[model samples]
Target: MAGVHVVANQKGGVGKTTVTVNLAAVVADTLGGTADSSPVLGVSTDPQASMLEWAERAGNELPFDFEQCHDNPKLLGKLREIKQYSHIFVDTPGSLENESILQAVLTQADDVIVPLEPEPLSFNPATRSIERVIQPAGVPWRVLLNNWDPRDGTADLEQTREYIAAKRWPAFNTVIRHYKLHTRAPADGVTVVQYAKNRVALEARQDFFRLALEVLGTGGDGPRHASAVNGVSSTNGG
Candidate 1:
């Protein structure tokens, strides 16, 4: 079914808007094309309007410009008016405690995607937001490790998983690494597909496509439940 998907966090600088803007562009580019002709709704609740800015940069490709909900509370109503769209992607402000923003999005969302950096510091806000805001709404959540540099074993992936284990949060298995393509996505106004053609960028593109499928109940990559050590394969039985 068509419903809202909120990209949120209680902290800042965790690539929240980056994820939202890129995912919207990705979905629009993938499904909203002439073949599917599905309308993908973009809702920008962040006062900064970073996602909205990215949509403007994206130009004519967007089925509709990102709708700015200045009142925040009016989001529910604003969303009600957009019937043509088969999916709604929303971006909320960082470190925000506005009930209306949460209420507006959660009250109607089909699912939620929380984009978090692979650091305990990042998880602090993200985890809390999920516990306090998201769970109460009773919607599904996909915890994305965004801007993650898994190579830094001690500081990044290992510690990240350590934090996830302690909290026992179910996170997405497929991740988009901290590649330049993600940062450059908005400036170039191109989806990763239209931008770089390297292994990393291509992998990220697939991860998001699978993400879209999961959201639409079409399923994604097989469950990501792997055992590792320092972010490496240290579970050898040999």
Candidate 2:
């Protein structure tokens, strides 16, 4: 089977869209060359459509094009019907109530990446979202830390880590540093690969590649049963 990875969190401004778009680009680069690579299909479900906008600004020349699914109740069924593509990346809305669309996607999804800001508020939503949608629908997920600053040991990083540890949740070990480059990332409308080789973007790219490997799984035959979508999917094949 094919994989569907949702970049979402109940809370807003956790860099959901940024992660979605860039992650898609990284996946493309990692697996795009070989015909056997599992292709990634990026779906923009958020009302704001930040990922969609980035796709537009980056021009239609990307390895994979981002599709706007409109968050209709029919979304999941619509996606599953097309199995030619290999993977799916969905950028969901920020509000918790958006579960209607999120849950529908998750029902068919294999995994999700919940971006947390290393704070209690960011930490809280993963559990709630899982309880409400992930567990209910039987989907797997990983919490990814974003905008991390180790300086705030007492309030941000440590607290969130302990909370996640207590809950026994899966989280990415790579931490995205808080940098002006990352803040300006979306405006540039490209993944770290497309940017200048600064230290910050370089690290971000490596971390994202780690996430891509996690998505693609070990030994990279790349997820089985690639989706039936129209184009060559964006994949992170080994």
Candidate 3:
């Protein structure tokens, strides 16, 4: 059966939809090759149907197969039975008001990607969601550091890492820095793999590809422990 990956977080604006769209493109770029069709399927369960809207704008240019299953988590079972793709990515709701739908998706997912913003306001809600919702469901999850800024040294990054470390949450080493291309991607109705032809876009492409590898447990060391710094695991577990 194809693996179901859910991009989730209870907090809004953490880039869950962005991660879902780009990562789907990354998977399609690799799995689909130059044949012009992808084995990856992008599913959207968000009430707003953001991924569907993006696909509509992208029209026939989207790399992977796209579908809208808004508020319908059961479609996952049927999709798995079809086994038509190398992997499936589901974009989920970011607000607590949609907790039931989010929980339903998480319960059916093979893995979860929690996009965490490196800031004060995001810490508690992300931690709570991971602990109360994800952990209890026994779903394997990794937190992707989104909107990271590495210019002024590693102080803020280190602090956020420490907080995650204290909670003992698993995370990826690839940090997604804020970029104009990422901000412009959704509005442009394209993903980095298709639209990232320039400097920042190229860098963003590499970031998501690295993230895709990590999620597949083929990025050298797999998902690292929260104490991992520069891909070197500081703790015993990974």
Candidate 4:
């Protein structure tokens, strides 16, 4: 059974799609199997279909298999038939009003990655989502501090981290800082690994790489696959 990781949160605008796409890229680019026989599958369950658009924009630039499954709740049942895949990354809806969709995705996911912004407003909803949905599903989860401003040494970042720690939530050590290169990806149809010329781009790439490592470590497995490449096979959601 391939590891199923879902990017979900009750609160919107937390960069769920961004994390979903990039982590899938890192896994497909650097981990298991060859790029030609891509191992990672990017599953988009969000009603907005942002991931679908992103895949179209990326074209051959994407490093993993991409799919849009509007019927996300059925994804879990179908995944069992796809044991060949090494990783499955699902991008889910973030609206509090979309609890049913989030619940469905969570029910099927083996793991969840909750990306939280560095703000007070982002914390409560995430915590509630984790407590009400994630814990009940018994799926292991980790929170990543996204959109962090390293220059702003105010208490926001620290307080948020402390809050997570206080609640005994698992989180990643790699903090994804806000960078222009990251913001430019969706617009430019580029992944961090493809942004080879810019230092900040390379830095962003490294963060995702670290995140991939952390995720893979959860299963105590390494990137054991074919030669690394730069492209992935694209597919539609089932």
Highest TM-score: give the candidate number: 3
Ranking by TM-score: 3, 4, 2, 1
The candidate 4 region of ten consecutive residues with least summed lDDT is: 224-233
lDDT of 2 by residue, 145-234 (tens): 887865555467778878777776666665665666667866776655577877766866776787677666652323322121223233
Please identify which of the two predictions, 3 or 4, would achieve the higher lDDT against the true structure.
3
Cα lDDT tens digits for candidate 1, 1-238: 4566778776878887777766776676766444236467678787777776777777765544467774657556566456777667888877565656766777776667778787767766786788888877766665787777646654677777777777666566657677777788778765555656777778778867766655555564321222221242211010
What stretches of model 2 exceed 4 Å from their correct place?
33-38, 150-155, 219-238
Model 2, residue 72: distance off in Å is 4.2
Cα lDDT of model 4 by residue, 51-97, tens digit:
89888899876888888886645664576457768889989887777
lDDT of each: 0.66, 0.68, 0.78, 0.76
Instruction: Note the clash tally of each candidate.
Output: 0, 13, 0, 3
Structure candidate 3, residue pairs in collision:
none
lDDT of 2: 0.68
